[model samples]
Target: MLTIPSLHAALAMAVAVAMFTAFASNRFRVEIISLMTIGAIALLLYLFPLPGTNPKDGLALAFGGFGHTALITICALMVMGRGLVVTGALEPAARALGSIWRINNSLGLLVTLLLAMFASMVVNDTPVLVLLIPIMVSLAHGGAMPASKTLIPLNAAILIGGMATTIGTSTNLLVVSIAADLGMAELPIFHFTPIVLMAAVICLPYIWLVMPRLLPDNSPEAGHEPRKFIATMRVGTESSWLEQRIDEFREKLPEGFSFLREPQTLQPGQRLAAFATADDLREAGRKLGAVTAPRWLIKRLSQDSAKAGEDLVEAEMAISADSRLVGRTLQTAGIEGVAVLGVAQAPSRGFAAPREMSAEARLAEGDILLTMGRESSLQEFAQDQALLMLDGARPLPRRRKALIAVAIMGAAVLLASLGIMPIAITSLAGAVAMFVTGCVHFDKVGRALSAKVIVLVAASIAIGRLIGDSGAATWMGASLALGMQYLIPPVVLALIMLFVTLLTNFASNATAAAVGTPIAFALAEQLGLQVEPLVLAVLFGCNLCYATPIAYQTNMLIMAEGDYKFNDYMKTGIPLVVLMIVSLSVILSITYGL
Candidate 1:
């Protein structure tokens, strides 16, 4: 009804508010956010009665993001990553890296972080980190490091590596293409690699040294707990302490020492045993007052099992939070018949040990454990334990197809990086090749598209498009320019990049690039500076989602495996974000002559 300038302003604000709401609220699944952003903007634009475009037209326009190329690309990349994981292309690499971890705890963590970062720069970071997440989790349980120490640092390194190449992350390419459209020269595939590499190097010490220390170890089942064994206690028919209450045992033998079993059953001189793997068996007999098959019996079982052509491969699991099995022991659960091969804790150097009775070294929530079995048997053990499976101990599928999967991935990257094909097509085609050539199965392509990430990327894309089409980007650019134009041009670009990186973490990189790119371009035009630094800022910004766990899919993955809190991410990520802003600014200013 209104032909006023304020009508345009009101429409733009509506679109911005919808997007901002999607980002700030974690209530809705990310996929729904995409549809909501698109729908809300379309409705606002149409209802406001803008002079040139009718509401009906604006309605379809805002809703078009569901079919956008950015949405397709995110889905395709996710599929390809899933294929690589299920087919086990990264397992060999994970094993090779895992051995280094066994060398020592701190060094092992450093290696894992470095490898995750490096692998991401060369291949895709998501799949690589996915492969490593499980392995790091298993290692944490076995070596005594807290899963929290390893997981966030691991994800941060992957993000840093993903920033190194255009093909490293889908968002990197999205930024490159958007910048090209904004009238910058075409970016070569490796155009930003050196800058990213340098920044990553400078950030390495923080990742290795300070991150783990500042990060709290919540998973007490790891090595830090003073109670090293989770044991079972049985009452004897003729024992002195048979009728003693739970409270009496609780008070005996050291503070923090706890015993777990049915009340009134734990008696003095009764047979009692604990469950601990080779890693944590140190306190098994002495502290827990428990026995493990009388030593001679275990030797006999080991020899007999070894002669059967089956040395048990250890598969590790982390206890689920609020699990029912937290206070139970292997023997009481009939660990032998139920097929529990062994048990162990996650490892952390500075983490404190729990003060409970090592014999009743009962499982608490978030305990990492080592279970031994044949690969096939271990899978069954993982399921039965209701434990979360971590990586490096899985069986590979159809090794014959490994070469085929590798080829398809390589060819697609070649085509896309060389500008011979669009990224979505390249990735989708690669996924098809993996299936047709038997690299993956037909019934399970959906595994590649984690519902959480697909929705997040799609919603962010819709929001980005709405922001662009509703003139929101232009208005925001003008506002941002008022304070930024007089500042050092490089700093402007860096701050903008950091802001986009935050958005990218919550939504998707494509959203950050597509939306932030235009704003950066418009802002650069207003400032009379070269557009390279501004565009580079958008590219760099889309990868900086280190502050929160939900900022990225890789972060979610580590949530179950690492037993980490949201604050763990903030402690480690905040400084890194600050470091990246300064590093990227200095590098961009020097390279692009800002």
Candidate 2:
């Protein structure tokens, strides 16, 4: 017999379905839809309050996400990530990974996937992704694969790894603890590891090869060739390349970098003519212990920046037709505060350099100058010289604070991974430390957070709470249980996994685990089937939070970086969901002898 749901339960289900539809359609701005969702939930609950709850309580429930610990943890994680970036703490890691990528794109992605997957087995998923996201983005900026092509695959690998162990995610621990409390045998940490590992064998190929193809290239400068610049690199006295033959140093240079003319043997303070993109030039300089501008200029700029309490920034300035710099060489351009590191001529003229051009490169109207200094100085220099400043002014890393930022991040991850304190507290403390230690500035904190993510998280929290509180989840579980008695054991297990997957994708992993675990136990009791497989089904399903951004924090974390739409998740994730459900269903059936 079918029973009609009460008004609150019915309304909650309707709201959830409608919200999912709106997100899928991609018709409205995510923020608008999210805010409207929150508004609808608050108004509906206020008009038709849940049993034993007043209107004020309803408002609190709807609005509580702004203060929710999960949101706080995410915000703090962003701030800490900003700290790492501003301090250049992750550059070495990025360079190492970029080397692998430079060798072979496929091999680099495979290594990245494996690293993320296995690391999350012991560490939590969020921090693992946090540590890797910036590295991947940096690689993308360095002319490797686009971040859009890599981040989703990386996120999937981490989620799968997180599914492998009981300690992989909080939701996994919740499932285990709930099952243990329900009188089931306590699952050891690695109890389900082999199963997820086996499933991963079936899934990794899809993640590495096909997923990247499905993702669009979201690089801001997609389809445009990076502008290459001719720069003179001066070897520092302490450089390892000092006293090496020019040919030997040439052989050691990175790809895309080349000398304009063969020079004499390398010597301290010797300048070599070279041409490469701005990023490649920076990389070459870092690797070879060389400076594009004079060491004294850099030192002076550093001192000026310190005195002004500002960070050094690199910016591009175009020589306008009417500019005073036209026909003047870089040495005589006489720009103050900013040092011109390189000159990029109009591409149609080709890269043919005259003899001694790097040292005496004449400024042309269409030339773009790569300069470094304080942001204020760059702006003022551009204005005074009638030069057009490019939009992006990238801050040079403050290497002095790099170690401090690294230590703070390590401590936060350590405490959270060791279960000493909740991630919320540790991450918050780390964010505060970043501010106090000058790793990230107080005024720059807003740059770290995304309004899209904020509103979406708030709305998702409200939806999750409403679904759990209004009996919608319970009603669905009961309906599943009623239908399961007629099905065979494998079908029942698959259905349970699918059910929890839907709940987790739409509501939350916590809510799904809370509602699904007892349902699994009851189903097992009624059907006289083994309880562990069913419980594992619920556990596995909770981690299959791939089909929506609201399904997991890491999902939203990658959204802005990847420039993903709601449809992007649905397109790539829905197939993976089916694959896992089928593979896990069979694996569980065989493993437990169902």
Candidate 3:
């Protein structure tokens, strides 16, 4: 049992975390909280001297997770996944999922969830979900269902299925190994699969139906072009948002520069729609309002025939100009397509540049300065600025690079699965191939690393090790068995598994495995139960990541993509989590002699 001081420490950490988390929605702030938790654990373990070790030793224990193989493995896996998407290796899979969307949005989500679950059962869940992220996004786009709804559910499904077999996730193997160390026979590869499948069945309906309703769609206004406003911009000697597709440069325009219009496919010299005078446009620009259209104005123009209506004015933003975009980077522009967000580069060999920044090359003269705004406003900006609008976009690579990207990932999987190398080595090798083969490239790798995720995983792992190293976990098990001491060993094993599942919702799956596995072993020893069932409990508990995004990388991966606020996960996931706890507990109890 954890003595008074350890309990006090744990409670202190809990209160500190709860307060911080209440207001930690800002991405950078959340990361700080995660770092602080890790630091606090280290400080207390060393300073206060938890039961087993001095404060410094505890600090060492917490910090040790920074060097754990699991963290490195996950980071590498993320890089490999990024490579798959950037190189088009995952396009075929995305296309397949897209076809499902063609059937219907709901059915498509259902199929994606089931497919993801089964796919993880066979392939590793991490890579499988990586390939599925883009697919889910595309499916949402294609079916007119916000991606925010589909990604989380799919991620949850994969995590659930990761428990189906000993080899499904590395945590399963870790639990099995720990159990074996305690003299229990290693679980067979498919030993607890039936129980997992039962849990999967109970979980799938909630993921498909309830989750979509709860998740928020952050990008609802994305495709919906803002109200077209009349504005003018004195295109500076070199402004970039001009003549770029409204969508292309939307992100680069200044804030409050929305109310953009689509192109009408007018000739360069054609008189575009006139909504307001040049003076009005300039007046609007002074307030940091709309800019000229980034892309050809034609793309943003609506052609609704329902009421024989071609256009209507709506009130959203005042006029703006390219001045706000002159020296800004795409990341800083934050425009949402009411007006052009950035400047379009001058046309070059066989293609026209958009109104935003390019990583490829620097600026040159006579490039059509693409400005963004409402149809008439963008025209005024171009006329006043002496800029020419371009024809169309040929900016990004359109050809599929699927074969090469998939081949690289496949090679790594083959190498690792066949025992030619360890998972980390093979995964790292694949990441290297992605950069070397022009799959993801070097600059983008950092974006994929995502510091928030790295810190969170490290902290969770540290807590798991602490729980295991301390006698806290052992006491928990011993206490549970005291009242049910007369139950059969198998029944006791199943109950222990269920308890582990409860612990997982608060602490992440990985930590649950690390801490709960050892405790399960201790319980087996005390109760004279077969260790295999306890090992199965550890794996099952670890895989139940449905209740929160912080527990699994896939959960976080889906968070932004799903447009989910925190409460959304709790409302939808709590029921499914509870269902798994009950059903899996009962199933394992019956099947394994509980």
Candidate 4:
């Protein structure tokens, strides 16, 4: 019999479809669509409240996600992650990993994938990715492989590991809790570990070897030529490298700089010339204990800037033909407000420099000078010196606080993983500790939170609640039960897995967990089948969120970093989804004797 849905169920279905359509079209911004969805839910539910619930309750359901613990946890975790980056807490770890990658790219990738997968089984997948992303990016820059090629595969492996434990991801716990509420026994932490482990074993080879080849290279260096500049470094008397040999500093030298020949010994006030990008020159100069302009010039400018409460800035500046600085060396140039870090020699425009450009090389027309100063003074210095600025100033890392930041983050993760406190509280406390200990500046907190992700999570939570509260998911399950009446038990289990996988990949995994568990329970009862197999199918499918970014929080986290498109997930994820569905169906059916 064809049955009609109730008004609330119909409304929920319509809104969910519309919301998903907006996401799939990729025409509207995710944040905007999420805001619109929240507005629609608030407005619609106010007008036509659920039969047994008050209007205020409907409003609560619509607006509650903003205050939801999961969303707060994500935000807090992001802040903790930001603290790690700003403090350079992960640099040492990144360098160690980069060494392995440098040894052999394939071996390094295999180790990274396995480590990420195994860690996620014990810890939450998000934190594992958070800690590893910078390391992977470092490995990519060190010529191992592009992050775009590795991150998606790494994320999929982490998801597989999360599926193995009952508490690996919040979604897993949600599924277990909902199943228990529906009269099923509470599952142990590793209740389904064997099955998920089998799936992992089957999929590990694809994740490690095949997935990266399917991805495009999207690192910052890809598809663009690097802007090169010539810069000179003047060794200062008080610097650590004042009398050090050039060869001693070779390993510590930043990218994009090379010497004419390795000097036997450094001399005080020695002029070292090199060609590199502005950013590279700054990094190299900082590490080399070398000043961009004359030591006296930088000292005087730094004193004045500190007195005026302004930060010192570094950037590349180009010399114009009519400039008064055209023929002057760093010692002779009467420039103020900026100090030179490095300079690009004339007639060379790329990374491959034929000869070393020396510090004593007089400024020439079109020579790019890596200058450092306060922003206002840098602009003034540019106009007064007849130089064009190349790029914005890079933020200096708070390297001194790296240990403190690492400690805070470690404490939070330890507390959460041990079940001493919920992730929300621990992560939030960690974020606050970052601010309190000056690990991260309050002004930079905005960098940590992605508005697109926040609003989307909120909207997805609302959609999940609506689908469940309105009985739409159950109605759909009943329909599936009627259609599968004649199918054998194993085939029926596969169909259930397929359905939940669709929900999980198209909607939030939390939403799928919330909606699918009850439906699986009801459908199993309706068909007089073993409910455990059907419920396990839902659990496995909910974690199979490979087909879309919106399906999982970790997916969204990797989007901008990996530079992935909607179609990228579809291309790579669909096969994984199919594999998991088929594999898990057989595992569940046989294990439960369905």
- TM-score (all chains, Cα) for each model: 0.69, 0.80, 0.60, 0.76
lDDT of 4 by residue, 1-594 (tens): 758999999999899878767766667887888889889988889899988888888889898878776677667766877787767675565555655787798888888877777767655677678778866875666567888999999999899988887656767766776666568986766678899988788888888888898999887744444466655567666667667776777776754566654567778777766666554565666666676567687678767755664546667688998999877886688665666666666775577344445756677788877667777888888888888887766554567789998899789877866677765678789999998887877766888787876787677678767877888877887888899989988788788878778877875566566667778877887799888878888888889999988788799889998899988898889988888888888888788887
Best of the two (2, 3) by TM-score: 2
lDDT tens digits by residue: candidate 3, 352-429: 545323312233443323333334444454455434455422112112445767777778767766667766678788
Q: For candidate 3, which ten residues in a row score worst on lDDT?
A: 305-314
Could you arrange the candidates by TM-score from highest to lowest? 2, 4, 1, 3
Over the stretch 119-163, how does candidate 1's per-residue lDDT look in tens digits?
A: 786466778876776677666655647777777888888988888
Q: Which stretches of candidate 3 lie over 4 Å from their true place?
A: 1-34, 44-60, 121-152, 165-195, 201-401, 415-421, 435-440, 488-494, 548-568, 586-594
- Per-residue lDDT of model 2, residues 21-111, tens digit only: 6765657777888899889999998998899999989999899867776667667776777777778776676677767887888999999
Better of 1 and 4 by TM-score: 4
lDDT of each: 0.66, 0.82, 0.58, 0.76
RMSD values, in order shown:
12.8, 5.3, 13.8, 5.7
TM-score of 2: 0.80
lDDT of 3 at 54: 62
Clashes of each: 32, 0, 56, 12
In terms of lDDT, the best-performing candidate is: 2
